[model samples]
Target chain A: MMRGESETYGSGMNEDKAQRLEAFEAEALGYADQLFRVALRLCRERGRAEDLVQETYLQAWRSFHRFELGTNLRAWLYRILFNVFNSGRRQEKLNLVPVEETISETIAWDPQTPQNIEDEDVLAALERVPRDYQIPVVLADVEDLSYREIADVLDVPIGTVMSRLHRGRKLLRSELTRYAQSAGYQT
Target chain B: MQVIDCRNYRELLDSYLSEELSVETNHAMLRHTEMCQGCRGEMAARRRLRAVLKRACSTDRLGAEAEQRLRDCLRRETAGGVAAIGWGRRLRRLFEVRGLFHLAAAVAVAAVITAGIGAWLYGAFDGPIARPDLALSPALFEQAAGDHEHCGLKFAVLSGPFEMPDSAVNYDPSYAGLEKVVAPAAAGLELRTVHLCGHKGRQFAHLVYAGEGSLISLLVTERDGKALDMDQIPTDDGIAAGMQTARRENLSIGAFQTTRHVVAVVSDLEAEKNRLMAERLATPLTEHLRRFEQQTAMLSRISFIGRR
Candidate 1:
């Protein structure tokens, strides 16, 4: 009698696992566009963005058993995408920040002018900000993660998240200002 | 309401926009904002920036065509086709076959040609060859021991012509076959089984021999892996020797002067074991070289001895 019960329990567990796999596959297909959007924002290329999303989905599918069904799947997928971006391609991580900040102590630049810039120009400028500043700004402004949630995702203190977000935005604004002045746009 | 500086207000703006501020803090921040024009302007600019960024980042604008293609590709990936394996994974799997024959076959028919050439060279050079002293001199050995806590030279000398391209010097798989022939002969020499990475990135079996400290490394690069027709000289103790070859069959040998040592890379010797064993068998090898030199000198009256 005990053996029979154990066999039935094992079969039930197998069925549950199969059902979960099917559900995860469905969710992955459904949210692929959103995941691809986040990856596209980070990578700025279509093929690479698709690869990043696919990698994220595959990882999510494998770990779906561990995912809490009630939690936000979008946030979970975003976290995976961010991790992929940070790990970067097999090649050297390209310094996303513009050449100026990277060589700053070596060279000085012209000061303060505010101007209106195009969205793409602003993004190209935002890329000039260091990743430490980039992460929070991208999360809070673009992905719309809360400051506390950003802290949770980044595994940093909320204070640190606030500081990064503030610094990130300021740098972004300065970059926009620089682009605008160069393009002959006035604030 | 407490008045906060622009810096502190700047920090709160992200939280406020995201609705992350606590009820009391939110209310206080709102009251402060109403009183502070500078903070209000900063907040407005930041909000505008955030809106622009959100709109810019949204890939919904990539539109239906791109989205459909991406979805179709993803659907194919999830449905389990060869596309899901990825290029890198597939390439790695291509080389991961366990058996030797399988790997050789997968590498191409060149293995068969390499085997044939190797067999022919073995047969041709199978004649009586003098053995050199296999171990380093006692003084040099002790010095090498002192400099290195753990050091050994793993060397293989090939007598046959190195094949070209895929079959050349370091790329030749049989180059390491000398180790099996020599290690047992050098028993009690304190040997270590080193991981044999292939020469020119081709895999080979390797070993290192150590007594106290000194190390000598012998590696072969497939001739095809690099441009050929160059000389190699190993110098250590006031003596140097070199070997060069242009054609597959012809090898040039010589003794050279150096500040420290005289080392020779034997290119035409069939057995690396014999080359190393030549030291222990020095009396016979010296006699042979002397006789050979005498005959050459008598024929042309040319000085055959290499000057120090």
Candidate 2:
């Protein structure tokens, strides 16, 4: 009804609106599977993830006035989902990292650091990474988001995102290597 | 091509492999990767890690239930005959007790105000009135009484047979009074309504105040005589004849005449209280009428010039 006055009150409004909405849905619906997947990972629960995804789509639709057509819809939706997750009052957990590496600037990563590994179990490894690190790494690798986009989505400094990505990959690799070994894979 | 050291290139290794760095930065990292095997190895490992994670994460899809719920949400938003906030529907939470209660209260208040204003405008005329010489005429009193009763019933029942046009709804409380003059100026009082009413080619400002379970109606109308005559009530400065108070069927009515108009208060309170309220209202309402007449004259002159 807010879209057009003629369509809202005129005789042919219903059929016209149905066609317009169908066109919009045709474009927005394909991203649902990906949106649910990311929200699921962010929330770590089924119920909350559904809510986050639903709100994200609804918000995207509401603010479609500002969205320029033919841009990266997936990234736009992800940004909205990330905002919902961060703004929602989730329980804070102190994910203890070694004091030396807690601050990104203070991290001392080796260029060719080695981990003892036979194979990789990336799914289990992804779950173990702290939320701060996991979000940037998953956005970067899984979603193919660039460093700046990851920073924008996570609402952190570019330098902090870079630090998280480096550390997150290292931690994920170590955990995956452990999972692989237990599963008797040699790599 | 610019040369780059291994340490800096290693820092930019991920961005370089992903081609996300700026062209200049990407060029520098490329030169380093081409020359240094160690940096190249770091880049390779990152690429492999990215590939594996992407594959594993891509496999994750929602079960049937979540998909259905999402579809239902979409259906409700897109085509359910509900007005969308923008292109999408509002995300109103289920079970908003406080919100619903506030909405109902707002509707009630709106109904009361509309009825009060409507009654003051049209419900107060008795046949065709004649120009009377008295400050407070019996005909005017009869009309005010009818208005009070009609508006009171409408307030109690929240529905009426009257219909108002869009132009008739132009009453804003802040602008209801003369400049810097408004209702309920006294303490422990609340304004019920203030409206412009008309009868027999004369207009009256009908201001109603309610507080302490008592209702007061102050009517200001044009005065045709210089002196107010009401049982020869004594006057302070010859304007507020506060000594004159009369009873009309368990209701106390009092009147005062200023330089240009007569203002009266009709209430259930004591005669002295009614006189005090009349005294408070009479002076300012007279001043407002004087200013309003001057502005109307000025506007007419301006429009006459434009037409010429």
C-alpha lDDT of residue B96 in model 1: 44
Steric clash count of candidate 2: 0
Q: Which ten residues in a row have the lowest lDDT in candidate 1 chain A?
A: A104-113
**Candidate 2: lDDT of A63?**
56
Which of the numbered candidates is closest to the native, going by highest DockQ?
2
lDDT of 2 by residue, B10-48 (tens): 666766766777888877887777888877766776677
DockQ of prediction 2: 0.16
- Per-residue alpha-carbon lDDT of candidate 1 for residues B1-308, written as tens digits (9 for 90 to 100): 55555556655676788888778778878887998886777677667777777777663444566556544433332332111222223223433432543544444344323433543454422222221111122222222222122212212211111112111112222332444444454455443332222221222223344332322222221221111111211112111122211112222111211211122222233334424433422223223333433443343322212211
Predicted chain A of model 2: TM-score relative to the true chain A?
0.73
DockQ of each: 0.11, 0.16
Q: Model 2 misses residue A139 by how many Å?
A: 0.8
Worst 10 residues of 1 chain B by lDDT: B157-166
TM-score of 2: 0.47
Give me the runs in candidate 2 sitting further than 4 Å from their true place: A1-13, A92-107, A111-120, A177-187, B63-65, B80-308
